[model samples]
Target: MSTVSHALTDSATMLRRNLKRMVRYPSMTLQLIGMPIVFLLLFVYVFGGTLGAGLGGVSGGRAEYVNYVTPAIILMTITAAVQGTTISIAMDMTEGIVDRFRTMAIARVSVLTGHVIGSLIQTMLSIAAVIGVALLIGFRPSAGPGDWLALIGVLVMMAFAFIWLSVAFGLASKTVESSSNVGMPLLLLPFLGSGFVPTDSMPTVLRWFAEYQPFTPLIETLRGLLMGTPVGNNAVIAVGWCVVIALGGYLWSKKLFNRESTR
Candidate 1:
């Protein structure tokens, strides 16, 4: 086989291996998937009506809150899913499995590639589940087929960016606990942005941060695609942020992986 073919084959094999681990040891994946679902239920059932009353564009009701919060929940799903990638990579590194892979005659990049691909697939599944629950709870969207497709594209881009960033976190951590801790910022970023509440509702300093954060633009873009809200320049900013993060994370992850594998 050619070099590219060899790399593809190796990566596919590693992908399968990681996916099987996800299935066999499902506790971590389940926790990651369940947290967002629980949050969705909690926010919609417990605090939706009160929050929705304060939110613009929607009247006061849990139903309105569901519609408003679904996009944020979907983003939360991505955040949770990428944290799983961090944990998985950290576990493999600390457990000597990565070292074993390094000793084999496989493509050097295959291991990380497999984790990225597998995590992307897992994240999509989690997103679908969250959306399904949202639909059951009266989360109606105004998006057409084209809008849905565009939404999926944006989500995949975001997931790809975060997955690599999480991989870098995994590689930089000396232990699984540290990896999880390192990824906490990612999990919390959605909450800090315009996900659950409007950025304008926040204090001046916080509102400024929320407006300028990367997640805010992505959340705005999602709102536009799903609810037909005005996206304006948020789409461009969201894509730009994804590209920058993906590039930075890829380079950082490659450098970390190479350095660690050599040791």
Candidate 2:
């Protein structure tokens, strides 16, 4: 087979392997899914009334808070899903599986590609679950089919960027524990942005950070598409950030993988 054909076949095989592993050992994925669900319930039912009231124009009700918070929660789901990617990659490295693969004649990049594609699929499922829960809990969106498609595009871009970053974290770490630690910032960032609350309501310093941070633009773009809010330049900014991060992370991950394989 030609080099490209070999790479494609190897990647497909490895992708299937990783996906089966995900299905067989589902604890991590379940935990990731469960975290967002807990957050959704806690914020919407427990704190939604007061938080919703605090927003300038919206009615201080659980329903309004639910709508406002769903996009943030969706972002959180992606963050959580990527944690699995880091852990899986780290484990594969530390357990000598990568070394075993190196001795094989398969395309080298296929290993990483498998992890990336599998993780993306799992993250998409998790995102779908979160959105379903949000809909069930009175989180109404005004988006039509076109808006939903746009929303999915934004989310896929975000996932692509973050998954590559997670792969780099995995390759850089010496242990699965360290990989988990490195990936934590992905989960924590949503709170620091406009996810749970409005950036305008935050103090000046934090407000500034929240406004400029990558997640803010993503959240705002999602909100615009789903809630019918004015998107302005947020869609452009979000896509730009995704492209930058994806490129940086892809390059970093490849460098790390090559270095480790050489060692």
Per-residue lDDT over 196-230 for candidate 2, one digit per residue giving the tens place of the 0 to 100 score = 88888899999999999999999899999999889
TM-score of every model? 0.97, 0.98
lDDT of 1 by residue, 1-263 (tens): 99999999999999999899989999988888899999999999999988988875545678788888888888889989999889889999999998998889999989999999999999999999889988998898999899999999999999999999999988888999888889888778888899999988899999999999999999889989999877999999999999999999999999999898678
- Which predicted model would earn the best lDDT? 2
- The TM-score of predicted model 1 comes to 0.97
Alpha-carbon shift of residue 121 in model 1 (angstroms): 0.5
Show model 1 residue runs off by greater than 4 Å.
Answer: 56-59
- In candidate 2, what residue range of length 10 has the lowest lDDT sum? 52-61
